[model samples]
Target: MKSNFITKITLCGLLLNGIYSHAQQTTLEVNTSKTITKIQPTMYGIFFEDINFAADGGLYAEMVKNRSFEFAMPFMGWSQPNSNTHSLNANSGIATPVRTSQNSNNPDFCRILINDDKGYHIINEGFRGMGIKKDAKYNLSLKAANHNNAIKKIILQLIDKDKKVLGETVITPSSTDWKDYSSQIIATATEAKAQLKITFEGTGTIDLDMISLFPEETWNNRKNGLRKDIVQLLYDLKPGFLRFPGGCIVEGRTLENRYQWKKTVGAVENRETMINRWNLEFKNRQVPDYFQSFGLGFFEYFQLSEDVGAEPLPILSCGMACQYNSGELVPINELDPYVQDALDLIEFANGAETTEWGKLRANMGHPKPFNLKYIGVGNEQWGPEYIERYKVFAAAIKSKYPNMIIVSGSGPSPDGAFFDYGMQELKKLNADIVDEHYYKNPEWFKENATRYDNYDRKGPKIFAGEYAAHPKGVEDGLKENNWLSALSESAFMTGLERNADVVHLTSYAPLMAHVDAFQWAPDMIWFDNLNSFGTANYYVQKLFSNNKGTDVLAITKDGKPLTGQNELYATAAKDVVKKELILKLVNTSGKAQDVTINLSENNVNAKGKLIILTNQNLEEYNTIAEPTKIIPTERDYKMSGKKSVLNLPAYSFTILKLKMK
Candidate 1:
């Protein structure tokens, strides 16, 4: 009897232990063997608040073929070509005539002779071993130095190696005063063929401003004209679509400064009025004509989307309500002009000959109606006042362009009419998409990734327009600009992929900013005048966005928050292209965790590749001085029996891609 009692007590203890384990159990079962999600092939894109992909604080836009600041002009000896008044201190180009060879006192032509190496200008240059061919079709532009020398017409010429003219196009100068000029040509390329000399073939000593060449392949949606390098980089991201000309900079005084799509068309150098809201911090915030010369305009955005193999997501300012600090919202009675702007924008994008905008679009070259399927009504607009404004635009736009998808933007506030009334308005108006912004710490990211997992997928889908960890307070021993949220972003992205069906599309906001630009925190891409690079977050995003899959495998895990410290995460993706399983693991622990992967049940035999982002010191960062301090690195892997074991470093994020045979 005693022996029997002892056995029963032991059994009970074991049973209790089993019960506890069950209570703390967590399992992820991928119903299918592998899931694939298709991501826009380009891992990068720009948030374009400024020139090229230089956000001065945002994402990557490879628009500028060669980047240089207005200040750096003199350093490069770009003396603005004309006038004694030219001074970098004044931030003014040579506004006067530069040609001294003429007998006339008023040699009002701006010219930069490439006759000497030191005398060359950035206008005709490119980076990464790319530049205009001496025989390539080209265009010439000049800021007419003086009204007296105003060109009646100008000829664009391309020359070959033997100084033989190969191509020329004569274009009549349109402006009475200094304005940009462009004319195209057809030419073939050859080695040693150099120099494009524009003889004031016109009656006047052509006051030259600037001239450039265009390759057959051009990207649209460029600001301050377009930066080829930046555009090329953006094209690399392979975005499915793009929403343009905004973020906090949507507000403009009157319609002229506003992104009036009409004025931004035609030859790029001629588009007038290039002003950035960021430059407003300086006194007298007069936006000197930096030449919006919108060579790449709204129409170009559409073309670029097509060229980059992505869809077009165009955004227009809603009719009535104005942006905060953008002056007061126009009342309902007086919103007619803004409303018409939105309408005209759509017509310009999708209309055919019958409409003037459409005709202009065709005249610019593309005769086919651009595929403008998505149209956002205002950016980050919220509140009942905003609701009234959104409703007005929504009703008008949907009525006019019925097939277009509408996206609404709002901050991540649970309160305010922006959320309550915005959703209510969407429900009332049958809105198609809702956009939300998030910036938080990595810890916050882990919890928030799961936050929307249970969101209502049947209703309006979500667009995580902009999100990243905005870790504010200074941490112990961390550098002032240390990027601590990269690992967190990766973990969150894994969650995003798991729910891609509900999350149709997402992009990090304030995408492109210059390193000198600091308007907002947590910018994803950074650049200087000459060189550009992406942040840690930028690389993580590149990896994931470039390798998305179509199906999702349910995740089954046998681990709980390890060691009472909830700082471990891992994910796997099946390589559709290479036929492999990819897994990413993050162990943010002070001590390492021995990670073992087992797939014997699913016949999950595989090989692995592990890439890591690790910094010995949490406060470590890559300054301009040392850029590779904390970048991702690849390592060899060994997989065992039913399990693959991994020893993860502290505070490290690892991605493992498994190739299943």
Candidate 2:
């Protein structure tokens, strides 16, 4: 009797399994012969902002903070540690900040007066301490004026938290006038939290400016370049374009603090330093020490885009401040300079060597134009004021460069009065592209997967300029770069791809953050002084970008696109150049999904590649310690005739690539 009971239970379980499998099975029909639209090369890209120490302390490869003594607090990063062994007292030396009238761009310089040779030294606490590697070389540079030939020699050393010198270099004062000095220091051991110590060997006075340090091994092995590790991650993504120097930074808290391209170009030292808008944007995460050194300026941004094989899409200010802050506006009559800035930027990027701005670009080492085709007028601005300013900018830019594509702003929110108004006005103006931003919960992303399905085809194209799925509502304080958020974004991106004609460009916002000094959460990448890692969302983006085909293919379930049907979303594209069919399926449910893709044509090869990215735990995310916690796994897949059967795991994003025979 017991055996019979066990057998009966097993049979019942099998019956239930069969029923569930039948219910979950989905058949997607792909029209391989019909090309819906030509997918834009700029469809998948990166949006870069300088927030969260992304530039000065993050990517710029500059180890020294307050390099030019130009921070609001001149000696913010410099501190004089009293040493018991050396008997260094306060009277040993005094460094006073001096402002000279000659150089307004870089007016501040430190003047050190040593009373005695009692070991007077100042240490720079590098952006939360430097990361020195064993056997690696660090290049140190500084400008010094040995006043009256008083100071004899200066010694520079890299020290750890315990003050153990890892490397040292010395420079002898050979001139009374300001002279440039550079030396290389080779470390004996690795230290993640190291500091730079500068000691004066003799008594008297010395004027110092632009004290900078960088790893000898930079991204391109160029002097004063970007962090190699960080740039390597970006290069691997194969992004189509790079939108840069943005977010709220383009529109400063006040007009005076806005990011001016003219000031950022020319010379590195002459680029004025300003307080970062994010310095005090969040009260709970205020970083008063945050500032922009502009070492990685406009030229560097363009070079980085080129190095990574991406188009440069630069966003400029529209004579208006951040609405969340001062909201100061330049009168319509006085907007000539702002409009000229846009026109001049075009010349700088695509002009000839004889042109004024192009001459500056050539002088900066890149004689060839960046071939810039897109320029954004403003960032997240709304209302009639924005439309007014945008109209003026549009007219001026069109008059000069009619073929140039202008990316106009559509406010901060994805939908509302501001977004609606901006869209209507831009359509009336026949705008080339409109930028939209979205920061919402994971559910919102999944629910809005078909947001662009009904968009006007003849109107301006969409640039999903800035977007990220906050796992929890941003206010709940539970924002994380977890698998759930990334999975939801993948699901939503299927809709973005399905409507390829409407959405031309897309990128995840807040590209990078310093793990130790970040003011924002949910960034795509995170890094510290020593290392960096891409979040789960980063892999999702990578898969889409790397596999974005040349043309879109119609993939439908029950004669309609599969978007949030039975917790599944999908899009298909054909890589004409590679002669392959690409299918992206995202299952956002907890149960495994059985999907059968039926192709209208029988040209697909039996052998294909399948890449799967999934995590049972939705909250799982990547960190510096466990960077590959949720990376993609790939394997060979076999297709039967024109039908491909796939069992997508719970909460997963799957990609199937098959060659056309």
The TM-scores of all predictions, comma-separated, are 0.69, 0.95
**Global lDDT scores for all candidate models:** 0.53, 0.91
Per-residue error at 358 for model 2, in Å? 0.8
RMSD of each: 12.5, 6.6
The candidate scoring highest on TM-score is: 2
Off by over 4 Å in 1: 1-31, 34-46, 51-140, 143-229, 253-256, 281-293, 320-322, 333-337, 352-355, 412-417, 441-443, 473-481, 558-565, 570-580, 600-605, 635-642
Ten residues in sequence with the least summed lDDT for candidate 2: 1-10
Q: Over the full model, what C-alpha lDDT does candidate 2 score relative to the true structure?
A: 0.91
lDDT of 2 by residue, 344-463 (tens): 999999999999999999999999999999999999999999999999999999898999999999999999999999999999999999999999999999999999999999999999
